[model samples]
Target: MAQTTDLDLVHVIKRFGSHTAVNDVSFSVAPGEFFSILGPSGCGKTTLMRMIAGFEDPTSGDIRIRGKSMIGVPANKRPVNMVFQSLALFPMMSVGENVAYGLTSRGVSRAEAEERAGRMLERVGLKGFGNRRVTALSGGQRQRVAIARCLVLEPTLVLLDEPLGALDLKLREHMKIELKQLQATFNTTFAYITHDQSEALVMSDRIAVMNQGRFEQVGSPRELYHHPATPFVASFVGETNKWQGEAAGAAPDGTVAIRLPSGTMVKGQGRVADRATLAFVRPEAIALAQDSSSLGGLPNRFEGRVSAVLFDGANSSLLIDAAGFDEPVRAVLPQAGPLAGIQVGAPIHVGWTVEAMKVFAA
Candidate 1:
């Protein structure tokens, strides 16, 4: 049986003076699932998050948690906790004190709150560091302390507003796994916000990719990567190479065709067309074949030349100038195998399967 989804946002909309920030958006998150809202700046991700966190009231529509409405409720009363990018830990207080702040305010006795705080600190990998001031802790540690503080209350859901934004690349990457682990450990529903696609892909069970106040697409990391719903999603989620083509035709079996500029027709079977559609492809989907490059009437078969070859240790990227495409197409191949001999100006045959291509009309 399918698991019931939690955290429903039904037609949620938020508007500021003379501007609509979140426009009639809707999606649900499953219970205990790590979900992320991803988009560029000014795309309304943060504004939507604020509404969910009860910081900003929605101009219209329903915001539900476990099926109850959260329309007029304030942030403090919501069954959710949020950790901000700022790490908002009280600098003057010890780590223990910071973690106990919520409990102490809620009428818990000092000794009891402090003891619970200590346990939470340990849970976040800060056991013996409780006495240290927040200012003395490193960026990552401060982040953990801030999370420990909010999570000590054991909110059913935790909202993270770019909590790893201040960390370095390596630490940001490290914290992604740590955050996932913490979520699993606590079995908490986490609503995360980020502009970083990699971060969303790494952490989320499902992702809602926002664009200009609406969700452009929502799916698992693999779904979004392998089958983007729109051109915006294909470009935003990862590296993609585009080829402009008009809808030549579609196969009776459901594969679609796009006639490229070079008068060659590349067919891929994944479009339910409503208008002039565009073919979306991933660079890594293109294969470098050892045998002859010909798939008779196969979907997504194309011929191109290696315009450039840039080698990374683990993988190499080949910029191929495919027939029917004006710009160079990028293809990823193994660094130290049959693809190693591929050089700039060398004739190379690259192709992707129909399943690897995503088509979008708009």
Candidate 2:
């Protein structure tokens, strides 16, 4: 990997009158690493990206590339390029012209610009589409063209703002693999923004989960998956079951016990406090059984009637209605091997391993 240098942000804040779009948020990116800032529509991920690209100036704080500060640098003067969500490709221009736009703006000659443009197109899997009109290209081709234009500049860093949000599911999946490979081949730092958690998990070396202009957690995919730092992350990362309870005793082995209103004590692993409010358990961790729930060995267990069953190829998603644990406790059963005679309307017990239970305060 060709590392450029570290990119740093210090107390970066963006405000619009009294509303702060981006609070005092800060994070860093390692050169040549794929880092993603993920959150919902108004979470300020895109706002931070624009500020870094110089399209918008931070109201306060500072941003640095390598070791040089970039407080007031103009967009074009920065050693960075961005592929906008709308792509911003010129409609009147041809495919080759669109790719060579950056080069021409930088004073490259027409002949050299055209040649380099063709090569860049080829690099992004659009080899011979150069002579065609930009309008003639497909959505995926347009995306590649946008990427090629940015890459042609060979900047120290690249900002991709939801580049794959426009493509279909199958194309989006394929492009995810291609985009990761493309970044490695270019060996440039990539600071991408997306609202899709699955996309962030699949593409990034590290993910920063943001909420309301603040980062809720930052870690690698597996770390965020198995050990979410917040309730928002645990519920948002993937499908999870949540319960409201209060701490009842001391957990010697790091397993906190939360007592429900019905006197049911659900013991599991989490940071427990005297007034703990929430418990999180991933659906995949919960299992359905006909025998005893083994609640003593499990952190949480509930007896319920099967409400629904959905067979999704490799796994079957089960929904059970249980007392004290409302909202339909769910579980995943193996597809190749069903859980033997389990059906809707059958009485069953739902259980989860102690380690599978995640407790969070509030």
Candidate 3:
């Protein structure tokens, strides 16, 4: 049996006068899946979400929810709820009243609405704080209340538009875990939109990397991180050291050789029709050897001096100025290795295998 889709966008496009915000976008979300549209501001993810919520009509294509087309449906009639970055919680109402407002407005009895709201509050880890004022709650608590309010109505799909953007960094990190747990516990389909790569990589079951009104790539977190399909994805999705070069030729093993402007030759596994190309290697992919002799015939080798030591506890990195390279290359240092004590101006040998480098047309 085929699994039912929770939300589907078929060739969806949104335009404002002459500028296109969303360009022929198409994708589907599975039931109970946490799908995220990740991109920088002005990428049209918000416009697409509005189309899904019926706040804005698509210039073309269909928006479907649970196999039903929602072409002309009003926002209030749709079986979806959106949680905004500001949360949009009512300040005048108590937490309980705020949560039960939707149900009571739909003619649900006050007693029953309050009862369901209480249960929902408990489900979201706030059991006895229903009568408290919204202002009395912490940022994360208020965020949970906002989510609880939406979940109380048991909507078919929940749209979160950067709901954690207002929280402090520590709280945002904490809520990422909490939000994922809440979605799993309720088994609700969550269509989250955010520009934060760490948030998407940490919580999303699948992520669509949007750019310039289109999806650059769509895949799991691991897949996008390890095997980016586009140069934008490679640069945007994570930290990498990029080298601009020209394609020399393909080796016998099918790896494309690239000749950098510095006249250094490097090999990577990819097809590039354009002679002008770019190569990216993750900071962690390059390992530092204490001496050149320790490289032991690595496919790629470069001698460099440490220009800076970026110490961030376990995530420390070293900035190296390699000979013949115009820009400094960054390489992450192991938590407790010989390279951990590497200082500025220290000579280090950097080495990485050919397969670790990703080549793309410039």
* Candidate number of the best TM-score: 3
List residue ranges in candidate 2 displaced over 4 A. 1-4, 293-299, 340-342
| TM-scores vs. true structure, each candidate | 0.92, 0.93, 0.98
Measured by TM-score, how close is model 3 to the native structure? 0.98
* Residue-level lDDT tens digits of model 3 in 248-310: 998666599999998998888788889999999999999789898888777888899999999
List per-prediction Cα lDDT, in the order shown.
0.84, 0.85, 0.94
Q: Across residues 1-362, which tens digit of lDDT does each residue of candidate 1 receive?
A: 64476689999888889899999999988889999999999999999989999999999999998888999999999988999998888878998999999999999999999999999989989999989988888888888898899899988779999999989998998999998898888888999999999899999999999999999999999998887877898889988887667777777777777777677777665665664666777888777664444544345555777888787765668888777677888888666666687767777767777767676674
lDDT of 2 by residue, 1-362 (tens): 55445688889999989989889988888888899998999988888999999989999999999878899889889999898878999999999999899999999999999999999888888999988988988887888899899999888889999989988988898888888988988877899899998889998999999889888998998899899988899888877888888987756787887886666788877766657668888888887677554444664667888888887765568888886765788788655444654788988788888789888787
Q: How accurate is candidate 1 locally (lDDT)?
A: 0.84
Error of 3 at 40 (Å): 1.0
Give the range where candidate 3 is weakest over 10 consecutive residues by summed lDDT: 333-342
Stretches of candidate 3 off by over 4 Å are 1-3
Using lDDT as the measure, which candidate wins? 3
Each prediction's number of clashing residue pairs: 2, 0, 0
- Of 1 and 3, the candidate ranking higher by lDDT: 3
